[model samples]
Target: MGGTGTTGTTRRISRSTTAALAVTGLVTPLTLALGAAPAQAAPACTAGTGPYQKKVEKFLGRPVDGRQSTADCRAIKAFQTKHGITPNAGYAGSVTWGVMDLMTKQKAVGTNPNRDGRCPVNKGRVACVNLTLQLSWIQDGRTLVYGPVPVRTGRNGDETRTGAKKIYWRNIDHYSTLYNVPMPYAQFFDGGQAFHQASVSMWNPPGSRGCVNMTKTAAKKYWSLLRNGDDVHIWGRKPGT
Candidate 1:
């Protein structure tokens, strides 16, 4: 087997664009073409605003006081780490804000699944994964048990499969036979593609080899809520897929 790179979700923002956004206000849409990809470093907390803060809170499914407090940073860091954001520094920086903004926008446009339609009829316990937004939710019948949690799916050459399946097996501490990396709380649904916990980058050049990677916290909650043979429905194409 070959050495696979660590997984992450990074955007290609040019330095010139970053500088220009600082001048014209980061809210303005960029007209300049994006240049080469750079390191997934976060910008300073210079673009704070009520709207941005509100959006962050909304995406996190919680109420933020518009202060970006320590708790808020922790939440943001978790989200970043889950989605493969670099640094995972817990700041609402440009990359973090960008992904949140895009997710909200996608929801508004009806591209992602609605909260109302997250689970199937009469399904007691199920996991719904939206690849487009890299978000997941667990539902028991009509009640949302957990999530809208950030996740990182297979990337490019290793794209995760979408559709219905069941968790046929589980492992609290598992190692990938292919990559030899830790896959905590693994719930195997599709062959070689389980719902597991793994470290992520915001924009790492490498993605998972068909698994749905989530944060340790989210994965633990999933392990607790899900048992073998529970339904798992994965759908939607990732943004730019």
Candidate 2:
């Protein structure tokens, strides 16, 4: 049910705005004008303190002073850019902080993501999806077979339904006509929501339509490890969705 959008190529147009002084044969005027022009300054980082400033600082390992600083802005901006957040002006707004908070919780999950015993251990080969942390892993009995890798789930209104399901179908080279995008290594678990490889960044905000979007490597691994009829257990709510 979910698919990624293709990125369009950006075409840059360079324009020459220098007017030649024909009276003097020398090109010194043009050279001087070009040299005299000041280099464009970089966009200023956000100066005012954001609502989640302290939280973001703590997450980034910066001093939790509850105020914005130049270093803090740069660090936060780098993180936001890495996660595909827009503007990335280094403002510790709710969206940026939300992503950080989710990461913090996911990190706390550690190596044993299924310690709660929520997913059925005796189900043989099972794929466990933790929507809260936006992670998925394959387990054989009590032994881990695959990941606790990061994933991108459904957005606000189009939330991925949580329940016990089984992999009913699989297509290595799948294409979604509805979304007009490729869904590689597609494995259908629920009615329409499936596990597939997406071109979009997994850390991007909002999230997919209804599918569990994974990296190409993770999807390839899942394609090799899982098959039709494998148990799929999904639980918890995707934060901010």
Candidate 3:
């Protein structure tokens, strides 16, 4: 309902933090603040260096229980190796950890992206893609998230989905319908979905199907700026401009 704000995560991502939760229950929020950092220098969530991977290692120690953590990446590799589970390549995501949680623990990773604000992208039918719909809360001005975000996209051959409902639905990802997202998290064009990162020229193309796609960075930031009951409107190419 406003502009973009800021905040911080890890279901797991990159070659950093490797602290994994016990496979006994559900995931608790921000419990990996173990070894801990001083405060100020605790690292911004969007500081990169593998995203949540680096930060988690800064706080969590070498090994929790018996898992080994070289850095911030969740101990996916080690755990996978020891327990006979398939080791991860280098990338870490919600689904990765979500699966780990299921095999090791019966917990579901918390969706820290839940927010209390709304995405502000109302440009009156200019034909933009609604890529990421994360926690892009607006503070002032025309600020955009410029960070990680969450969203749902089109399916089948007709990716241009149309509807007006508040749903925290999860079905797409970089592996799914996600193709690309906007950069700098600039929320423009309608109901907070004007993020066009790579392939900038292809945006609003005759074939995009109206769903916003982005790199992990922009997606996560978008999530940190939102809350509940936020109005989200996504429209592009509805005929006659």
Candidate 4:
């Protein structure tokens, strides 16, 4: 994703085919003839409120209606992109569902820095930005929407403010009036501390000016999942602070 562009590419390939390619170089002519099998069709969207759909709905922070909707597809695509799943065609196919299932299992019992104490009381949707780990996560109540994604916070004297905040404003294409830089998907929580798309590498030097800088793709997802006035908790500490 470009700094100012939120679009993402999708790559689709069968999981079995992917496995076949990995073993192709070692196959003999006889082996190829005897072992090669026809590739199966890719998984399609499971639209009804079955077990899979319910799982997807849970991850998306939506009501687990048995039927799939446009909103569900959008959420699925965002999740696929976030986890590097290819051909992010917004389908809750086998691979997509499998990944989501794993995610749910991994998070079923809670994880570090994301316990009950992190979110605020009565706040339904919470954007938890953990500076110590340089990760961001969005959750609605106890359901995880997105993240633990890499981010670049304010540097040195410009450390991102810590504490509870609300996203009071949003600008899809906000340009920094103070620094004259592009701040795409800007969701301002504090005075000037917003979560925006940035081009900086998370592990490198030179961070932002009190903004939570996420990748354009991530910022787009955040913009979609978060609404104005949602709780935004900036906590923990970045290393070397």
**Top lDDT model:** 2
Alpha-carbon runs more than 4 Å astray in model 3? 1-159, 170-174, 177-204, 215-217, 227-229, 236-241
Best by TM-score: 2
Q: Write one digit per residue (lDDT tens) for candidate 4, span 12-123.
A: 3232212211211111112111222223233354343334777777766777875778778666656555544555556666666755453343344333437646665357
lDDT string, candidate 3, 22-130, tens digits: 2222122222211222222221222123333432232233333322234433343332222222323323333334323322221121332223223233522122123
User: Model 1: how far is 154 from its true place, Å?
Assistant: 1.3
Please estimate how well model 1 matches the true structure, expressed as its whole-model Cα lDDT: 0.62
lDDT of 2 by residue, 119-159 (tens): 78998999999898888888899987776777899999989
| Candidate 2 regions with alpha-carbon error over 4 angstroms | 1-44
**TM per model?**
0.57, 0.79, 0.26, 0.53
Error of 3 at 122 (Å): 13
Kindly indicate the candidate among 1 and 2 with the higher TM-score.
Answer: 2
Alpha-carbon shift of residue 180 in model 3 (angstroms): 14
